[model samples]
Target: MVLAHAEHSGPRVLNIGEVLAQLSDDFPTMTASKIRFLEEKGLITPNRTPAGYRQYSENDVERLRFVLSLQRDQYLPLKVIKDYLDAIDRGERPENLPPGVKVSPRIVSDEFAAEMTGRVRALTEEQLRTESGASVPLLQSLLSFGLIQHSNGRFDEHALQVAKACVQLESHGLEPRHLRPFQAAAEREFGLVERAVSPLSSRRDAASQARAAEAAREISELCLTLHRALVQDRIARMDS
Candidate 1:
């Protein structure tokens, strides 16, 4: 049984995979990446083996469990959790962390936020059709082709933009049926992004989630830029 803030002087330590296996049964969302994130935030310092592997003591595990509990049960933001951990490290018994506190840490850069911001209001199907000049059949085609998405009973900004783009494409005789390859290519790109951020997304922390999101956006942007450049090169070759 793990005790809260349990201390141990023995040399027993667990590796990242072992730690995840041990904690996953309890904290189903726990991951090796999250453990690393906690270490990065100075919440729990594990020893390093001769081969540069992370070795966590029993106390470190307890501290990690404590911090994760605060996150899952209390919903305390990472900054608050770090402050509490700092207090504990100073040999101070900190008060109970408040529950359900909504704090947005500056986990994302301002430029990234600006680049990624979407329309705040969700549009219904009718509203989307009216705003994007897309007919019902076209909207349905977009939905069937997975070009638009609706989650929790709301169509998001991406769907709106896709509808508008499809409308414009129709004017140029590029039908929705011809756009399947674009969606498939996008999915492939997303697969690459997911693989790239596997280390960070493996963690379940707020900071990791935020960082992973930003990284995904940046990677996607890079992929789009590359695709555009390649298309431009093809156009130049055709002209030549």
Candidate 2:
């Protein structure tokens, strides 16, 4: 299990040799010297035991994996990768990820980390309908109502999610036309989020842009929670 923090009370820490053993399969060329060089370059910082032995947390291992993947796959220079890591450490999502490289969270299972760098498949219209189990008329309704959209004859994961949810709601007598208010409400909520993050977003620096994106994500989640709570509170009144 990956521990978020490197406290001794948490998961067992790996010595340098153990860390190499864990990573060697994917990075056979990796060595103690290379790891040390990375540390000198400010790429990673493993903890030191009482006797001066290097100890690495699971998060450190994942960070190393990310750094190595960027170097090998994207051929990114250490400076660029360091900047990306700095943004991530600050809880901001960097914008310069290569096409298929996804940076999973530090506290991820080994299996999950192994599968982290894959591409998101863009579904065709037929594939979206098949995967979502959305009927032709329902799909048409979703398209007309602006509940879902496609680009270049392709739909992304978000489109599929909206289609599937619309299918489920259709059974409960909620048609696409009846869901227009949701799209409007989403637009209004986005306006609020956009306005709140505008100062950060308007800045030209990569760090500022990343901060703006993170802020928007956080604000959007809060808005969703408030919307859900308000709806639930009204529904509870019917039980009184």
Candidate whose TM-score is highest:
2
> Which ten contiguous residues of candidate 2 have the minimum total lDDT?
1-10
Question: Could you give candidate 2's per-residue lDDT for residues 50-98 as a string of tens digits?
Answer: 8988888777777889889888876667877776676555433455455
Reference-based TM-score of each model? 0.50, 0.60
Which residue pairs clash within candidate 1?
none
Give lDDT tens digits, candidate 1, residues 111-186.
3223224224567888998999999999889888888888765786678889999999999999889999999998
Listed per model in order, the count of residue pairs whose N, CA or C atoms clash below 3 Å is 0, 0
lDDT values, one for every candidate: 0.70, 0.78
Score candidate 2 by TM-score against the native. 0.60
lDDT of 1: 0.70
Q: Which segments of model 1 are wrong by more than 4 Å?
A: 1-120, 151-153
